[model samples]
Target: MFQNRHNLSERQVEILVGNLLRYGVLFSSALVLLGGVLYLIYHGKETPNYQIFRGEPPAFRSPEGVATSALSGRRRGIIQLGLLLLIATPVARVAFSLLAFMRQRDITYIILTLIVLTGLIISFIAG
Candidate 1:
């Protein structure tokens, strides 16, 4: 029932999406772990001052900033970048599914996926 007329099968697409999610999660975990280790190594001895509440720096607030900071070897940035990647994994899956649906000429799913994708983009921008 899942077979398609083209070379791309639904089962194959499922497998690919599964792999994409698995690898994306694993890679993000690794980044976060690495960042944590680095952070601990550098700041483990410091005591936190609970009296003051500090928000994240402006440099860690946006994707481009996170990428730049991560590339520059900032520990918090690395962690933030990992979180960003984790968030992006499902979005990537949705995008891939959209492409797959287009390939299969499944207009219904393609439209639905587009709507979902647009919503995601809007939320990201609005936030």
Candidate 2:
């Protein structure tokens, strides 16, 4: 006989998800703050030409570029990485929800969560 067939309660799972979101936000904020400080330290002395609006340098354009620059201690790339983390947090939450729904054996919710997860994946791929 399977002991405690009813494992995690819905409320417990909800609380776990809430904590995930809270911690994710906190971590992303910290990364952004650190990036901001680094940005100031690196660029504070540079004089910008306000008359002509300039775009970000080549190293900040794409994900690979950002990662490469970030590895090289570029603050803009660090900020981009932080923003990527912020973007990924909700996707991670959805992934966790999918697993939770599977564990609960709630068919309706499991299907619904799967659909949502699939949509998220498709959007990411299409983009």
Candidate 3:
């Protein structure tokens, strides 16, 4: 039984990663679409004022804020959350690659992936 529990092949890992990316994108898109529809339903009739410019609220800036607003069913917050998810997808892929490299005992790849993951994290945090 222990012998039957073998590690995944390279191709299997690739397929799993592909599926993860595909599903992540699809799910995020769905959220964005849902949020857009709800936003339109709520504000479609409002007239636009081109001379005035406004930015996203503070509540939609941070991940925690987005999550809170999204949980409260705020349309803009839902959209922001979807965008955040889109950004996170690639970061997640890199993280998964790091794990895969570790599992495969590929030191070079593990180090490279760790560097990339670290860069991504730093960029997000620094921004």
Candidate 4:
């Protein structure tokens, strides 16, 4: 029987995954909080006009818009970008799992993870 020299123990893999999730959440949370603070600083004094259902300004509706807004120091854009990051965290975890499974020579898990990744991509693209 042949042994893979580079294979890691399950404990090490779990630790890496745990750290990935923890750091991803923390970093995304910090971004959101910073955006919130900036938003409050910029618009804290504005009076609420609750009678009308005015939609979000055009700049906040899409990823590109959010990025542009963030670059221009728009608080709302920053918030949206943070939200995007939050959404991406799990996707990133899945991707990382796929890589880990590949590295571990886990054929079953690799295939399963690939299916999951495909579904995620399709849903995001078509839904």
C-alpha RMSD values across all candidates: 2.2, 3.6, 3.1, 3.2
Superposition TM-score, candidate 1 onto the true structure: 0.92
lDDT of each: 0.95, 0.84, 0.89, 0.85
Write the number of the candidate with greater TM-score, choosing between 1 and 2: 1
lDDT tens string, model 4, 58-93?
Answer: 997777898899889878788888888888788888
Worst 10 residues of 3 by lDDT: 1-10
lDDT of 1 by residue, 9-32 (tens): 887899999999999999999999
Candidate 2 regions exceeding 4 Å error are: 1-8, 49-68
Looking at candidate 1, what is the lDDT of residue 50?
A: 98
lDDT (Cα, tens digit) per residue for candidate 2, span 1-115: 6446455477788888999888988888887889999899888899988999888788766678878877887787788878877878898999999898888788998999889
In the range 5-117, model 3's lDDT, one tens digit per residue, is 23546767898899989999999999999999999999989999989889878898789999999999999988888988999999999999888888888999999999999
RMSD to native, candidate 3: 3.1
Q: What's model 3's overall lDDT?
A: 0.89
Candidate 1 lDDT score relative to the true structure: 0.95
Candidate 4 has its poorest 10 consecutive residues by lDDT at 2-11
Ranking by lDDT: 1, 3, 4, 2
